[model samples]
Target: MRRVRYYQYGGPEVLTVEDVDPPAPQAGQVLLRVEAVGVNFVDTRFRRGPGSGSIFERPLPGRPTGDVVGTITRVGPGGDARLIGRRVAALAEDAYADYAVAEAQWLAPVPENLGAGDASMLAMSAPVALRVLRSAPLRPGDTVLIHAAAGGVGHLAVQLAKLLGAGTVIGTARSARRLDFVRSVGADVAIDYSEPDWPDRVRAAAPGGVDVVLDAVGGPVLQASLDLLAPFGRAVVYGAATGKLEHVPVVSLFALRSVTGFNLTAWRRANPDEARREMDELTDLFAAGRLRATVHAGLPLTEAATAHQLIESRSHTGRVLLLPGGLGPGAA
Candidate 1:
């Protein structure tokens, strides 16, 4: 089996592909012949260096972990034998490999009609976007503002807001291309957040002030977002991908507003049923052709480093996938 590993924290160059023995599944786990890997912005953050959101207490060897769609080849003790040949999507650690292990209990059976890349998007990004929007408790006819609206979660959130009944959807991106893409995805308005007067522009579009803010870009953008909220409005910060220090500006108690965050793991643990419901909703939307994940590019498994580069560059319009090509039951 081949996998990507980095013993030290650094840039994309640290990721190396090597052939090694495939890992066996543990109790309640199933081994998958991984078909595709989702490259998340947070995974790049984990690779760059230590951060407050890191999964580890100290720097350690890193193996990219993200959404993986694959076929079940084997199962460990206590796992269901009948699922061995079923294709599924899962969030797995140590997953930038040809084969990865995922928990059988939570496996999402991928429909035969769903491609690996889309299944990978459904595995994580779509659900996270849904969860982020709900964090602020979006209401019908609410004026919503979405930051980084052309990125993976961002793009999905834009379309979802409309479906969820938001009256006016405002999206922001750094480049004109991205802003255009945001508008195409259902944003009623799109602004260039990179401009100095971006916030002012946002105010011009919605002078009454934004009703909900879904932000992933951190640093200055987070602070600015707080200032743009209407009285009683809410801002949900799910990630800070700026690669810079992130902090919030002070808000007066009399402001009648709030800032919240959505940590996927914690949320799932607290509201398992709701989490499942969100995924089901996304699945239905995709099936009905009302929602779809825009695939930016697909690279081979050995070129995992390049995939990470594409994500870190922030140039891609949608999800970047790594295809673990030609190592599976279907191989000739």
Candidate 2:
């Protein structure tokens, strides 16, 4: 088996690919032949250090923490052998390998309409967007704003908001190149956040004010989103992409507005049933052609460092997939 592991954490250069012997699956776990792996900012944060307060106090000895989409090849005791030959997307023990073990319950059946690349990308963001939309209580005719509207979760959140009946969707991009792409994903209004008064543009485009706000950037942008919300609007903060946390003003809620933060990790732990339910809904949407998976780039597994560099650049438009078997974009 081959895998990418960071002997020590610092930068992309810390990640190195190496060949190793495959390990046996544990109870309730399935060993999957890797197809595609999702490269996420959370993975980067974890790769950086313990400053982000990840669950793993110490790096898993030698393994990297990630997830993948693969076919079931073997099962352990109490696992479903019938799952063999199943095409599944899983959150694995260490997905950066050719064969990784995943708890049976953490795997989702892949839809025929979606391919391995898209399925792998959705392993994280799709469920996240669904959960955030549910938390926003998205309703018909409600105007909404999404920060970092071109990033993974933001892109999915935009489409999910539109599908859930948001009357108008506004998106913000720090660069001009991303503006059109943001609008193409169902954003009625796209603003240039690179400018100081971008929020003013959001207000101009949405008129009265936005009814719901999904923020991935958490610096001045989060505060600006709160200011753009209409009375009785809900603001949900999901990520701190800016790498800085901001203090919220409680008095702002007096205008019938509310502010809350959502961490998918906590949500998944608390409501596994509902989480699975939402993933099913997203799968159905994908099958119906109502939602599309945005894949910006795919790199060979041995080039894990390159994948990390691309993600850290913050220039890609979609999820980055890693090919564990040195497969290219054409891989199944």
Candidate 3:
């Protein structure tokens, strides 16, 4: 087996691929012949330093990509034998490898019609997008704003919001090209946050301001999002891709508007059953062609460093994926 690891954290240069012995699954786990892996900002954060918070019990020299899609090759004791040879998507630690272990209970069967890359892309972002939308009070005909809407979670949030009956879907990106891409994914209005008056643009587009705002970019963007809300509108903060929101005053909540933070990792830890239900719903949506997984780039697993560079650039829209075992864009 081969895996990507880093001895010290700083930049993409630190990551190196090494050949190693394959891992054996422990009780209640299944060993997957990994087909695809999803690369996220969090993976870049982990590579840069330890500030991202720990997912493992103890800090290790290497970190894992969180989303994986593969076929079950081995099942440990207490794991379902029937799952062997089944294709599934799951959240796995140290998934930047040819094979990885995943808890059987967390695995979701991938619809046969879905490609491995799309399955891996959806494994993490779709659930988070669905959960974020559910956290807010959304009504039919309500206008919704999604910041960083061309990114992994935001792209899915755009489609899911429209499918759930949002009248107008507004998405913000950093460039005109990116905004155009966001519009193709269901955003009724696309604003380039790079523009100083992007918030003003959003207001003009929605008239009375949007009813719900999904913000992943913090700092000034979060503040701007809060200001663009209509009366009683909800702003759900999911990530701080730019930086942390600073000096948010109590006055920001005027007019019954509110700000709520959503951490998918924490939410999943607290509501396991609900998490499973959300995953099922996302899978159904994908199978029915209602949800499309946008894959920005796919590279061979050994090129993990290159993948990291693309993600950190923030220029690519949608999920970046790594294909293991010689798999490429069109592989089944």
Candidate 4:
């Protein structure tokens, strides 16, 4: 088996592809033949270490741990044989390999028509967006605001909010060019966050104030999101893309408003059932042609360093994928 591993925390150069014997699944686990691996911001963060979002607490046993989607090939003790040969997506670590182990419960069936790359996208972002929206208690007629609305999680979140009956969905992007794509994805209005008074513009677009706010660009953005929320509204803080530190005002909760933090990794651990449920919904949407993934670029597994560079550069749009078979000259 071949897997990408990095023993030290650094740049993309740290990731190396090496041949190793594939490990057999232990009890209650299933072996999956890798199809497509999802490259997330956290994956890059973990690879680069302390500079990016709390990379491993102290010293992880080894570097490189993230999500993947693959097909089941073998079932271990306490695992159901029915899972063998099933196409599924799972939130497992060390997915940038040809094979990985997954607990059956965490695996969600992939739709027959969907390809590996698409399944890989849904494996992480969709589930997280669904969980965050649901946790914020979105209801019909509620106005929702999402920051970084053109990125991986943001784009899907725009559509998910619409499907959940959210009204006047507003998204912010630093680039005006991406606003068109954001609106096409179901956001009723799109704003360029580069503007000085973007939050005020969001309020202007949504007269009643946003009912729920999903913000990944934290720091001052989090504070602005709180100001944009309606009375009794909830603000879900998922990521801190700004790299700016923040001190939350606990006293603000008295205004019948609430602020909560949600990480997909932590949420998945706490609510597997909820995660699976949302995944199922996402699959249905994909199959029905209601959900689409925006892939910025695809590089060969061996060229993982290039993918990391594109993501870190922030010049790319949507999620970047890795094809284990390697890339052609025309490959992005």
If scored against the real structure, what TM-score would every candidate get?
A: 0.93, 0.92, 0.93, 0.90
Instruction: For each candidate in the order shown, give its overall lDDT on alpha carbons.
Output: 0.84, 0.79, 0.84, 0.78
- Model 2 C-alpha lDDT per residue in residues 1-332, reported as the tens digit of each score: 89788778688888877888877788988888988888777677777776644432356444666658888999998777899999888776567888888888768888765776558645677888878877987889998888888877778888988888889888887667678889888888899887988988987887798899888778888888888889999999888766668889888788899987788778889998888788788888877878876777778888888888887887777677788766554343
| Candidate 2 wrongly placed segments (more than 4 Å) | 50-63, 328-332
lDDT of each residue in 292-314, candidate 4, tens digit only:
77777777778788988887776
- Tens-digit lDDT track for model 1 on 235-323? 99887777554555554324888889888888888998888887777877776778878877888888888988888777888788888
Give every collision pair in model 2: none
**Candidate 1 residue pairs in backbone clash:** none
- Candidate 2, residue 106: the lDDT equals 69
Against the true structure, candidate 3 reaches a TM-score of 0.93
Pull out the clashing pairs in model 4.
none
The 10 consecutive residues of candidate 1 with the worst lDDT sum are: 50-59
Residue by residue across 198-279, what tens digits does model 3's lDDT show? 8779878988988898887778888878888888999888877654546667897977898888886788789998998888
Better of 1 and 2 by lDDT: 1
